[model samples]
Target: MVVACCFGMIEVVCVEAKDIQSAGLGPVTLAIDSGSCTGLTGPSGSGKTRLLRCLADLDCHEGDVSLNGASRESFTPPEWRTQVGLLPAESFWWSERVLDHFPYKQKPELDSLDLSPVVFEQPLRQLSSGQRQRLALLRLLANQPKVLLLDEPTANLDQDNIMRVEALIAAYRNQHRCCVIWVTHDRAQLERVADRSLTMANGRLDGDSS
Candidate 1:
Protein backbone atom coordinates (compact mmCIF):
# COMPACT_ATOMS: atom_id res chain seq x y z
CA MET A 1 0.00 0.00 0.00
CA VAL A 2 1.16 3.51 -0.66
CA VAL A 3 1.73 4.83 2.87
CA ALA A 4 -0.52 7.69 3.89
CA CYS A 5 -1.85 9.64 6.84
CA CYS A 6 -5.52 9.73 7.70
CA PHE A 7 -7.37 12.47 9.54
CA GLY A 8 -10.88 11.26 10.08
CA MET A 9 -11.93 11.03 6.41
CA ILE A 10 -9.11 12.78 4.60
CA GLU A 11 -5.88 11.10 3.47
CA VAL A 12 -2.62 13.01 3.23
CA VAL A 13 0.25 11.97 0.94
CA CYS A 14 3.94 11.78 1.71
CA VAL A 15 5.64 12.30 -1.66
CA GLU A 16 3.68 13.58 -4.65
CA ALA A 17 5.03 14.53 -8.05
CA LYS A 18 2.80 16.02 -10.69
CA ASP A 19 3.77 15.85 -14.38
CA ILE A 20 7.45 16.10 -13.51
CA GLN A 21 9.72 16.32 -16.56
CA SER A 22 13.38 16.83 -17.31
CA ALA A 23 14.89 17.22 -20.80
CA GLY A 24 14.15 14.04 -22.76
CA LEU A 25 12.73 12.27 -19.74
CA GLY A 26 9.44 12.04 -17.98
CA PRO A 27 6.44 14.12 -17.77
CA VAL A 28 5.86 11.68 -14.91
CA THR A 29 3.73 11.77 -11.79
CA LEU A 30 3.20 9.57 -8.77
CA ALA A 31 2.55 9.56 -5.02
CA ILE A 32 4.35 7.39 -2.49
CA ASP A 33 3.24 6.85 1.07
CA SER A 34 5.18 7.18 4.27
CA GLY A 35 6.97 4.01 5.47
CA SER A 36 6.60 2.27 2.08
CA CYS A 37 9.49 1.26 -0.11
CA THR A 38 8.56 1.63 -3.78
CA GLY A 39 10.77 -0.24 -6.23
CA LEU A 40 11.42 1.49 -9.55
CA THR A 41 12.73 -0.68 -12.40
CA GLY A 42 13.52 0.12 -16.00
CA PRO A 43 16.10 -0.17 -18.75
CA SER A 44 19.13 2.05 -18.61
CA GLY A 45 18.53 5.54 -20.04
CA SER A 46 14.88 5.29 -19.16
CA GLY A 47 15.29 8.40 -16.96
CA LYS A 48 15.15 6.69 -13.58
CA THR A 49 18.11 8.64 -12.23
CA ARG A 50 16.98 11.89 -13.79
CA LEU A 51 13.58 11.54 -12.18
CA LEU A 52 15.23 11.06 -8.84
CA ARG A 53 17.41 14.10 -9.48
CA CYS A 54 14.37 16.27 -10.07
CA LEU A 55 12.83 15.16 -6.81
CA ALA A 56 16.03 15.88 -4.95
CA ASP A 57 16.24 19.38 -6.49
CA LEU A 58 19.61 18.48 -8.01
CA ASP A 59 18.29 18.98 -11.52
CA CYS A 60 16.00 21.62 -12.90
CA HIS A 61 12.75 20.28 -14.23
CA GLU A 62 9.13 21.17 -14.83
CA GLY A 63 6.39 20.08 -12.44
CA ASP A 64 6.51 20.14 -8.70
CA VAL A 65 7.52 17.54 -6.11
CA SER A 66 6.21 17.83 -2.63
CA LEU A 67 6.83 15.97 0.60
CA ASN A 68 4.94 15.58 3.86
CA GLY A 69 2.14 17.89 2.70
CA ALA A 70 4.46 20.67 1.52
CA SER A 71 5.89 21.59 -1.86
CA ARG A 72 9.62 21.55 -2.60
CA GLU A 73 9.51 25.26 -3.23
CA SER A 74 8.43 25.81 0.33
CA PHE A 75 11.92 25.06 1.59
CA THR A 76 15.33 26.26 0.52
CA PRO A 77 17.39 23.83 -1.54
CA PRO A 78 19.52 22.67 1.37
CA GLU A 79 16.54 22.27 3.68
CA TRP A 80 14.61 20.38 1.02
CA ARG A 81 17.58 18.12 0.41
CA THR A 82 17.93 17.35 4.08
CA GLN A 83 14.27 16.32 4.20
CA VAL A 84 14.37 14.38 0.93
CA GLY A 85 17.85 12.95 0.68
CA LEU A 86 19.21 11.14 -2.37
CA LEU A 87 21.93 8.51 -2.29
CA PRO A 88 23.36 8.22 -5.77
CA ALA A 89 25.36 5.31 -7.19
CA GLU A 90 28.58 7.30 -6.97
CA SER A 91 29.05 9.50 -3.93
CA PHE A 92 30.85 12.80 -3.99
CA TRP A 93 33.53 13.26 -1.32
CA TRP A 94 34.64 16.63 -0.04
CA SER A 95 36.93 15.50 2.76
CA GLU A 96 40.21 13.57 2.93
CA ARG A 97 39.31 11.49 5.99
CA VAL A 98 36.22 9.37 6.63
CA LEU A 99 35.40 11.17 9.84
CA ASP A 100 35.74 14.55 8.24
CA HIS A 101 32.90 13.78 5.84
CA PHE A 102 30.55 13.04 8.71
CA PRO A 103 29.06 15.41 11.27
CA TYR A 104 29.90 13.06 14.13
CA LYS A 105 33.09 11.19 14.98
CA GLN A 106 31.51 7.95 16.08
CA LYS A 107 28.52 6.66 14.14
CA PRO A 108 27.23 3.48 15.76
CA GLU A 109 25.63 2.51 12.46
CA LEU A 110 29.11 1.75 11.06
CA ASP A 111 29.20 -1.55 12.92
CA SER A 112 26.39 -2.84 10.71
CA LEU A 113 28.70 -2.35 7.74
CA ASP A 114 31.52 -4.26 9.50
CA LEU A 115 33.34 -1.02 10.17
CA SER A 116 34.97 -0.17 13.48
CA PRO A 117 35.44 3.04 15.42
CA VAL A 118 39.05 3.26 14.24
CA VAL A 119 37.86 3.64 10.64
CA PHE A 120 36.62 7.16 11.36
CA GLU A 121 40.14 8.61 11.30
CA GLN A 122 41.27 6.78 8.14
CA PRO A 123 41.74 8.80 4.97
CA LEU A 124 39.23 8.34 2.17
CA ARG A 125 41.76 6.77 -0.19
CA GLN A 126 42.37 3.93 2.27
CA LEU A 127 38.76 2.76 2.17
CA SER A 128 37.47 0.25 -0.36
CA SER A 129 34.71 1.13 -2.85
CA GLY A 130 32.27 -0.99 -0.85
CA GLN A 131 33.26 0.80 2.31
CA ARG A 132 32.77 4.18 0.68
CA GLN A 133 29.34 3.16 -0.54
CA ARG A 134 28.25 1.99 2.90
CA LEU A 135 29.67 5.06 4.61
CA ALA A 136 27.95 7.38 2.15
CA LEU A 137 24.67 5.86 3.19
CA LEU A 138 25.45 6.43 6.83
CA ARG A 139 26.37 10.00 6.10
CA LEU A 140 23.04 10.57 4.40
CA LEU A 141 21.09 8.85 7.16
CA ALA A 142 22.59 11.17 9.73
CA ASN A 143 20.32 13.87 8.35
CA GLN A 144 17.26 11.72 9.07
CA PRO A 145 15.47 12.66 5.90
CA LYS A 146 11.74 12.12 5.80
CA VAL A 147 12.08 10.68 2.30
CA LEU A 148 14.81 8.47 0.80
CA LEU A 149 15.64 8.48 -2.90
CA LEU A 150 18.10 5.64 -3.34
CA ASP A 151 19.75 4.92 -6.68
CA GLU A 152 21.33 1.47 -6.42
CA PRO A 153 22.66 2.16 -2.94
CA THR A 154 24.09 -1.32 -2.49
CA ALA A 155 25.35 -1.91 -6.01
CA ASN A 156 28.97 -2.23 -4.89
CA LEU A 157 28.25 -4.38 -1.86
CA ASP A 158 28.76 -8.12 -1.56
CA GLN A 159 25.93 -10.51 -0.74
CA ASP A 160 26.41 -10.17 2.99
CA ASN A 161 26.63 -6.40 2.86
CA ILE A 162 23.62 -6.20 0.58
CA MET A 163 21.54 -8.02 3.18
CA ARG A 164 22.90 -5.80 5.87
CA VAL A 165 22.11 -2.65 3.95
CA GLU A 166 18.59 -3.85 3.24
CA ALA A 167 17.96 -4.65 6.87
CA LEU A 168 19.34 -1.32 7.99
CA ILE A 169 17.12 0.59 5.59
CA ALA A 170 14.05 -1.40 6.53
CA ALA A 171 14.59 -0.74 10.19
CA TYR A 172 15.10 2.93 9.59
CA ARG A 173 11.99 3.21 7.46
CA ASN A 174 9.79 1.45 9.99
CA GLN A 175 11.17 3.44 12.85
CA HIS A 176 10.83 6.81 11.17
CA ARG A 177 7.83 6.36 8.84
CA CYS A 178 9.90 7.67 5.98
CA CYS A 179 8.98 7.14 2.34
CA VAL A 180 11.44 5.44 -0.03
CA ILE A 181 11.84 5.45 -3.78
CA TRP A 182 14.42 2.78 -4.58
CA VAL A 183 15.74 2.35 -8.11
CA THR A 184 17.15 -1.11 -8.78
CA HIS A 185 17.66 -3.64 -11.55
CA ASP A 186 17.33 -6.69 -9.35
CA ARG A 187 13.77 -8.03 -9.48
CA ALA A 188 14.45 -10.35 -6.56
CA GLN A 189 15.77 -7.49 -4.51
CA LEU A 190 12.59 -5.58 -5.28
CA GLU A 191 10.49 -8.45 -4.01
CA ARG A 192 12.49 -8.65 -0.84
CA VAL A 193 12.47 -4.93 -0.10
CA ALA A 194 9.60 -3.23 -1.89
CA ASP A 195 6.04 -3.00 -0.72
CA ARG A 196 5.01 -1.75 -4.19
CA SER A 197 6.77 -1.74 -7.55
CA LEU A 198 6.54 0.50 -10.62
CA THR A 199 8.00 0.03 -14.06
CA MET A 200 9.39 2.96 -16.00
CA ALA A 201 9.75 2.83 -19.76
CA ASN A 202 10.11 5.35 -22.56
CA GLY A 203 10.28 8.25 -20.10
CA ARG A 204 7.19 7.48 -18.02
CA LEU A 205 5.94 5.27 -15.27
CA ASP A 206 3.99 2.35 -16.74
CA GLY A 207 1.93 1.36 -13.72
CA ASP A 208 2.12 -0.30 -10.35
CA SER A 209 3.25 -3.91 -10.83
CA SER A 210 3.58 -4.88 -7.18
Candidate 2:
Protein backbone atom coordinates (compact mmCIF):
# COMPACT_ATOMS: atom_id res chain seq x y z
CA MET A 1 0.00 0.00 0.00
CA VAL A 2 1.09 3.59 -0.57
CA VAL A 3 1.58 5.79 2.48
CA ALA A 4 2.27 9.48 2.91
CA CYS A 5 5.71 9.73 4.48
CA CYS A 6 8.21 12.55 4.67
CA PHE A 7 9.08 11.88 1.01
CA GLY A 8 5.41 12.05 0.05
CA MET A 9 3.50 8.96 -1.12
CA ILE A 10 6.09 6.24 -0.97
CA GLU A 11 5.60 2.50 -1.37
CA VAL A 12 6.72 0.81 1.81
CA VAL A 13 7.15 -2.90 2.35
CA CYS A 14 6.48 -2.81 6.07
CA VAL A 15 8.69 -5.75 6.88
CA GLU A 16 10.85 -8.23 5.01
CA ALA A 17 12.96 -11.03 6.47
CA LYS A 18 15.25 -12.80 4.04
CA ASP A 19 16.91 -16.11 4.90
CA ILE A 20 16.18 -15.76 8.62
CA GLN A 21 17.52 -18.72 10.56
CA SER A 22 18.07 -19.35 14.26
CA ALA A 23 18.52 -22.37 16.45
CA GLY A 24 16.38 -25.24 15.18
CA LEU A 25 14.80 -23.11 12.46
CA GLY A 26 15.78 -23.42 8.84
CA PRO A 27 16.20 -20.53 6.47
CA VAL A 28 12.95 -18.55 6.50
CA THR A 29 11.97 -15.69 4.25
CA LEU A 30 8.79 -13.66 4.34
CA ALA A 31 7.51 -10.23 3.47
CA ILE A 32 4.68 -8.43 5.25
CA ASP A 33 2.98 -5.63 3.37
CA SER A 34 2.05 -2.34 4.89
CA GLY A 35 -1.15 -2.33 6.97
CA SER A 36 -1.37 -6.13 7.06
CA CYS A 37 -1.25 -8.71 9.85
CA THR A 38 0.36 -12.12 9.50
CA GLY A 39 -0.51 -14.86 12.01
CA LEU A 40 2.21 -17.29 13.01
CA THR A 41 1.25 -20.53 14.75
CA GLY A 42 3.34 -23.46 15.85
CA PRO A 43 4.09 -25.86 18.66
CA SER A 44 5.63 -24.60 21.91
CA GLY A 45 9.25 -25.04 20.88
CA SER A 46 8.96 -24.59 17.15
CA GLY A 47 10.97 -21.37 17.02
CA LYS A 48 8.05 -18.99 16.48
CA THR A 49 9.27 -16.66 19.23
CA ARG A 50 12.84 -17.10 18.04
CA LEU A 51 11.82 -15.96 14.57
CA LEU A 52 10.34 -12.75 15.97
CA ARG A 53 13.43 -12.11 18.08
CA CYS A 54 15.52 -12.53 14.97
CA LEU A 55 13.40 -10.03 13.09
CA ALA A 56 13.66 -7.57 15.99
CA ASP A 57 17.45 -8.12 16.07
CA LEU A 58 17.09 -9.20 19.70
CA ASP A 59 18.61 -12.60 19.18
CA CYS A 60 21.85 -13.60 17.56
CA HIS A 61 20.78 -15.02 14.22
CA GLU A 62 21.77 -15.04 10.59
CA GLY A 63 19.28 -13.05 8.56
CA ASP A 64 18.57 -9.94 6.60
CA VAL A 65 15.67 -7.98 8.08
CA SER A 66 14.54 -4.73 6.61
CA LEU A 67 11.82 -2.28 7.55
CA ASN A 68 10.58 0.16 4.92
CA GLY A 69 13.33 -1.17 2.63
CA ALA A 70 16.04 -0.08 5.08
CA SER A 71 18.38 -2.85 6.20
CA ARG A 72 18.70 -3.66 9.92
CA GLU A 73 22.37 -2.71 9.75
CA SER A 74 21.50 0.79 8.62
CA PHE A 75 20.31 1.93 12.06
CA THR A 76 21.58 1.75 15.60
CA PRO A 77 20.06 -0.99 17.76
CA PRO A 78 17.95 1.46 19.79
CA GLU A 79 16.83 3.33 16.66
CA TRP A 80 15.84 0.17 14.86
CA ARG A 81 14.04 -1.13 17.94
CA THR A 82 12.01 2.04 18.20
CA GLN A 83 10.81 1.62 14.61
CA VAL A 84 10.34 -2.16 14.82
CA GLY A 85 9.03 -2.76 18.33
CA LEU A 86 8.55 -6.18 19.83
CA LEU A 87 6.21 -7.04 22.70
CA PRO A 88 7.37 -10.23 24.33
CA ALA A 89 5.01 -12.75 25.93
CA GLU A 90 6.00 -11.54 29.39
CA SER A 91 6.75 -7.85 29.72
CA PHE A 92 9.29 -6.51 32.16
CA TRP A 93 9.00 -3.38 34.24
CA TRP A 94 12.21 -1.86 35.47
CA SER A 95 10.79 1.01 37.48
CA GLU A 96 9.01 1.03 40.83
CA ARG A 97 6.22 3.30 39.67
CA VAL A 98 4.41 2.31 36.50
CA LEU A 99 4.63 5.86 35.18
CA ASP A 100 8.39 5.90 35.46
CA HIS A 101 8.78 3.57 32.49
CA PHE A 102 6.80 5.77 30.14
CA PRO A 103 8.33 8.89 28.68
CA TYR A 104 5.21 10.91 29.35
CA LYS A 105 2.19 10.57 31.61
CA GLN A 106 -0.60 11.44 29.20
CA LYS A 107 -1.45 9.25 26.23
CA PRO A 108 -4.81 8.75 24.49
CA GLU A 109 -3.83 5.19 23.67
CA LEU A 110 -4.27 4.28 27.33
CA ASP A 111 -8.00 4.81 27.18
CA SER A 112 -8.41 2.46 24.22
CA LEU A 113 -6.86 -0.30 26.31
CA ASP A 114 -9.36 0.53 29.10
CA LEU A 115 -6.60 1.85 31.30
CA SER A 116 -7.52 4.59 33.69
CA PRO A 117 -5.15 7.50 34.07
CA VAL A 118 -4.83 6.56 37.72
CA VAL A 119 -2.97 3.48 36.65
CA PHE A 120 0.06 5.66 36.12
CA GLU A 121 0.11 6.45 39.81
CA GLN A 122 0.08 2.84 40.88
CA PRO A 123 3.12 0.72 41.64
CA LEU A 124 4.19 -1.82 39.09
CA ARG A 125 4.04 -4.64 41.61
CA GLN A 126 0.41 -3.87 42.39
CA LEU A 127 -0.80 -4.36 38.83
CA SER A 128 -2.02 -7.79 37.80
CA SER A 129 -0.53 -9.79 34.97
CA GLY A 130 -3.34 -8.87 32.56
CA GLN A 131 -3.00 -5.21 33.40
CA ARG A 132 0.70 -5.32 32.80
CA GLN A 133 0.15 -6.97 29.44
CA ARG A 134 -2.26 -4.29 28.33
CA LEU A 135 0.03 -1.53 29.57
CA ALA A 136 2.95 -3.08 27.72
CA LEU A 137 0.98 -2.92 24.50
CA LEU A 138 0.11 0.71 25.11
CA ARG A 139 3.76 1.49 25.72
CA LEU A 140 4.73 -0.15 22.45
CA LEU A 141 2.10 1.77 20.50
CA ALA A 142 3.15 5.06 22.05
CA ASN A 143 6.43 4.82 20.17
CA GLN A 144 4.55 4.94 16.86
CA PRO A 145 6.57 2.08 15.47
CA LYS A 146 6.42 1.20 11.78
CA VAL A 147 6.13 -2.52 12.58
CA LEU A 148 4.88 -4.54 15.57
CA LEU A 149 6.10 -7.96 16.58
CA LEU A 150 3.60 -9.24 19.10
CA ASP A 151 4.08 -12.52 20.95
CA GLU A 152 0.87 -13.79 22.51
CA PRO A 153 -0.25 -10.26 23.30
CA THR A 154 -3.57 -11.30 24.76
CA ALA A 155 -2.56 -14.48 26.49
CA ASN A 156 -3.24 -13.18 29.99
CA LEU A 157 -6.53 -11.41 29.30
CA ASP A 158 -10.13 -12.58 29.45
CA GLN A 159 -12.18 -12.99 26.29
CA ASP A 160 -13.56 -9.48 26.58
CA ASN A 161 -10.16 -7.90 27.10
CA ILE A 162 -8.70 -10.03 24.33
CA MET A 163 -11.18 -8.58 21.85
CA ARG A 164 -10.39 -5.10 23.13
CA VAL A 165 -6.70 -5.61 22.54
CA GLU A 166 -7.36 -7.06 19.11
CA ALA A 167 -9.53 -4.12 18.15
CA LEU A 168 -6.92 -1.65 19.33
CA ILE A 169 -4.23 -3.42 17.32
CA ALA A 170 -6.38 -3.48 14.20
CA ALA A 171 -7.14 0.20 14.57
CA TYR A 172 -3.47 1.03 15.01
CA ARG A 173 -2.53 -0.91 11.89
CA ASN A 174 -5.20 0.86 9.84
CA GLN A 175 -4.18 4.26 11.10
CA HIS A 176 -0.44 3.88 10.52
CA ARG A 177 -0.42 1.20 7.81
CA CYS A 178 2.11 -0.66 9.90
CA CYS A 179 2.93 -4.35 9.60
CA VAL A 180 2.08 -6.86 12.34
CA ILE A 181 3.58 -10.28 12.86
CA TRP A 182 1.40 -11.85 15.55
CA VAL A 183 2.29 -15.14 17.17
CA THR A 184 -0.85 -16.83 18.38
CA HIS A 185 -1.95 -20.32 19.28
CA ASP A 186 -5.64 -19.67 18.71
CA ARG A 187 -6.72 -20.67 15.21
CA ALA A 188 -9.90 -18.67 15.64
CA GLN A 189 -7.84 -15.59 16.46
CA LEU A 190 -5.78 -16.08 13.31
CA GLU A 191 -8.95 -16.23 11.24
CA ARG A 192 -10.29 -13.11 12.89
CA VAL A 193 -7.17 -10.92 12.74
CA ALA A 194 -4.70 -12.11 10.16
CA ASP A 195 -4.69 -11.56 6.39
CA ARG A 196 -2.59 -14.71 6.03
CA SER A 197 -1.59 -17.60 8.29
CA LEU A 198 1.51 -19.74 8.50
CA THR A 199 2.42 -22.69 10.70
CA MET A 200 5.87 -23.51 11.95
CA ALA A 201 7.17 -27.02 12.53
CA ASN A 202 10.69 -28.23 13.23
CA GLY A 203 11.92 -24.67 12.62
CA ARG A 204 10.28 -24.26 9.21
CA LEU A 205 7.15 -22.39 8.22
CA ASP A 206 4.46 -23.63 5.82
CA GLY A 207 1.22 -22.11 4.62
CA ASP A 208 -1.73 -23.05 6.77
CA SER A 209 -4.80 -24.42 5.01
CA SER A 210 -6.91 -23.97 8.10
Considering every candidate listed, which one attains the maximal TM-score?
Answer: 1
Clashing pairs in 2: none
TM-scores of the candidates in the order shown: 0.93, 0.91
Assess each prediction's global lDDT (C-alpha) against the native: 0.87, 0.87
Error of 1 at 198 (Å): 0.8
TM-score computed on alpha carbons, candidate 1? 0.93
Q: Name the 10 consecutive residues with the lowest summed lDDT in model 1.
A: 1-10
Compose the digit string of candidate 1's lDDT tens values, residues 110-146. Answer: 7777777766778887888998899999999989999
Model 1: CA > 4 A from native: 1-11, 104-108
The 10-residue segment with the lowest total lDDT in model 2 = 1-10
**After superposition on all CA atoms, how large is the RMSD of candidate 2?**
3.3
- In candidate 2 the C-alpha lDDT for residue 52 amounts to 87
- Give a tens-digit lDDT track for model 2, residues 56-133: 888888879888788989999999999999999999998877766666754545777787877777888888999999
